[model samples]
Target: MHIALVTETYPPEVNGVAMTNQRLVRGLLAKGHRITLIKPRHQEAPPAEHASLQVHEVFGIPIPNYAGLKLGLPRPGELERLFEADKPDIVHVATEGPLGFSSLRSARKLRIPVSSTFHTNFQDYCADYGAAFAARWMMAYLRWFHNQCALTTVPDPSLIQRLEKDGVQRLQMLGRGADTVLFSPDKRDPELRRSWGATAHSPVALYVGRVAAEKDIPLTLEAWAAARKHCPELKMVVVGDGPVRKKLERQWPEVHFAGMRYDEDLARHYASADIFIFASTSETFGNVVIEAMASGLAVITYDYAAGKQFIQSESNGHLVSLADRQSFIQCTESVIQEQSKMPPIRAAARATAINYPWSATIDRFNHLLQKAAKTEQITPQIDIVSNSEQSTL
Candidate 1:
């Protein structure tokens, strides 16, 4: 299959979206499929040398205040000309951005199959930038943007339900995968654990991913504060960097910040931790939970989205109740006190992660693209102005 994967982020960026696309691209190339990877030029992007992967560099404007990265803006007619020059059977927009929108418009003009992935919640993300009121407007824009594509893929059934309720047409369940080989129990480094003030028996809790307000990071701090009452050595290791890093580190100097890690280095950090705590309420899929699970770590997360789908409370790890912070603390401490119960929990978690493989996931994406190309383009059946204000939760 000839596929053009358009995304705003790509390799060397080191986030869930980029990491996910990297794996999918590698897998697709291995399966004898060609992929034209389109993305903005980041300072850290790897060399584009793969024979099967064609890299198209787009003009990037700095994402204000953000160093080493930029965003691709809209240029519809230029993209249309590119599509006309070299056509692909499938045009997949992996991220929702100006570049993706332009790609969609171009693909539509060329009468090619079009598809997209719902990787993040920009509506919820606006709140982090102090534009909370703009969430509704953003949601309305997203609904219209995605509905134009023939197929839209998200990671969970819960999100699929939510998107359907929000009038998202032709929604598809496209699960993400983790790298089991690197993120195995064998990657655990006792030396590294000791360096972080963790004794062999002391409980070590972890939060890995981007450090942003929308990540619900403050809740992790709250949970850690509660955990410290019972176990002082209940160390918290935060392994990622973002605009909030300085503030978070200054606010809580005792916490260890490992900064951003990628590939095998990241896997080691996941394996070394005793318990994985994901307090985020806004995740679409929570791929880090699966990565931690694949690395054989006991997980404690809320009972929704990724957590509800994977964590079986008391069976694998505790799934904290949303309404009761005290109950959450109690359940968390109980698990930590009996931290001996964690090995089996971690094992079961790792066992569950093996079910999601990148090869199968990418193959499913290809199949969906092929199927959508044969179906009628998803234009609205009725013309009714959608209320942009009522979409926010």
Candidate 2:
């Protein structure tokens, strides 16, 4: 099947969206499906063209106050033209941006079946931008936009109920997976542990993700501080970089900042850590939490969305009620103080992550596509206006 994926962000961005979408697209290719990736062009990108898979580019403006990121504006004519030439069997939008909305409208214009993925909490993002009242408007717009698609996929099931209550239509439960091979305890290096000031049996607490405002990173710092109060021998390590790096480094001078990592280095960081602390309540799915667990690190996150669905409290990891700042800190302390009894927790954490394989997730997605195509009434092919100069699809 020919699938066109539209998103504002793609590879080299080093965020959840880029990493997850890369896995999905690569999985789709391995499953013998054709994918046309449509995204905003980065500065000094490979090219506006592609061979194995088609790549349609659009002018991107820097996201306000987010210098490292670029947001796609409407490229309606360009998309319409591309669709006219290389008609996809289905259109999948991975982000809700100007490019996404343009694809939705163009797909409707051409009478094609389109699908969407709920990858971000756009409404919450509005509040993060100091426009709290705009959240309702954003939510309403999301309801309208997603309702136009034949299927809308969300990574977390609990979000389905919430979206349905808000008048969303035809939601699909699509979960993501972790790379266990790259995230296992075997990757833990004795030398790396020593670098973090960790002894053979000392606890090494770690956080591996973007350090941003919405991540509630201050709470994580507090939890670590609480944990340290109980276990003075504990070593703290942070393996990712973001806007908050300078402030975080200054705030905790003793903690190790490994900075942004990828490939084997990232794996080593995950494996070396004894426990993972994630305080974010804004994620649709906690990719790092699963990655940490797959690496055999006990996880501590909120009891909602990703964590609540996978964690069974004392069984695998700790899942405190959302925004329970004090409880979260106390839980961290408990784990560190009682660190000797962590074998069962670590084992359970690994076992829980075993089922989350990219192959399985992609297989289910393929099944959903087959089902949708079989059940959906076929629409007549309409040529999308394919003028290279025009920027709408």
Candidate 3:
């Protein structure tokens, strides 16, 4: 099948959405599917080259407060022209940005099957950005935009329920996977742990993600402080960079800040750590949690998204009540106190991760796209409304 994928971000972006999209594209290509990838061109990165993959770069502007990310601008009729020239069997929008809106409009104009994936909680972001009042409006817009698609794919069942409750139609659960081979306990390096001033006995707490306000880094730090009071030898390692990195570095001078390590280095960071902490409540699906678990780190996260989906609390990992900062801290202390159970918990975490493979995820995605295409063939075509004319409607 020839598939057209529209997204705002792609490879070398150092985010979950970009990485997942790249993985899906490669997986689809491996399955002999021709792909047309439409995304924003990164200034510093070279274009991706593949035999079955066709790349289309569009104009984009840097997203405010997101240092390395860019949001694609709407192209009125460009997508329509592309689709008409070499029409695809199906269209998949991996983001809900301006580019995605245009893609939906273009696909509809061409009477093509179009589906979407909900990767982020943009409405929840409004609260983090001090625009809480706009959350309802943003959610309403998202619901309307996704309802236009043949299907809307979500990463978690919890997200499907929440979006359905909010009146978002055609919701489907398309779960994520982790690279177990790349992220394993075998990747642990003694030298790396020593570099962070962590001894064989001293526990290392790891946090890997964007160092931004939306991540609730302050809550993680607070929990670390509480855990440190009991385990004095506890060392914190933050493995990412963002807008608040400078401020966080200043505030917690003792913490080891390994900014933006990818591939093997990232795997080593995850493996070398003893425990993983994820404090973000804004995530639609926390990919880092699974990555950390796959690396054999005993994860302590809130009871939702990936944590609730994958973790078997106290067995594989620990799950605190959502947004309960005090409970989050207490759970951290419990993990610290029961150090002997860490190995078993870590083993169970790795075992759980092995069940979720990329092949399975891609297979499900391909099946859904095929189903959507088949549905489009049987359904009657409707008049296409261009995105530019959406405001008037």
Best by lDDT: 3
- Per-candidate TM-scores read 0.93, 0.91, 0.95
Q: Rate the local accuracy (lDDT) of all candidates.
A: 0.81, 0.82, 0.89
lDDT of 3 at 277: 92
Looking at model 1, report the run of 10 residues with the lowest lDDT sum.
380-389
- Residue-wise C-alpha lDDT for candidate 3, range 181-249, written one tens digit per residue: 999999999999999998988999999998988999988988888999989999999999898999999
Task: Give a tens-digit lDDT track for model 2, residues 1-393.
Answer: 888889888766768887887787877787788888988888655542334577777888987545456878755487888877888888888888888888877776766678888888888877766798778777877876777778888999889998999778889999888788888888989999998889998889998888777787788888998899888988888877777788988988988999878878899999988999999889988799889889999899999887987888888999999989999999999998887778899989988888888788888788776565444533333333224312321
- Determine which window of 10 residues in candidate 3 has minimal summed lDDT: 377-386
**Candidate 3's TM-score:** 0.95
How accurate locally is residue 312 in candidate 1, as Cα lDDT from 0 to 100? Answer: 88
- In model 3, how many backbone clashes occur? 0
What's the CA error at residue 6 for candidate 2, in Å?
Answer: 0.8
Candidate order, lDDT descending: 3, 2, 1
lDDT of 1: 0.81
The candidate with the higher lDDT, 1 or 2, is: 2
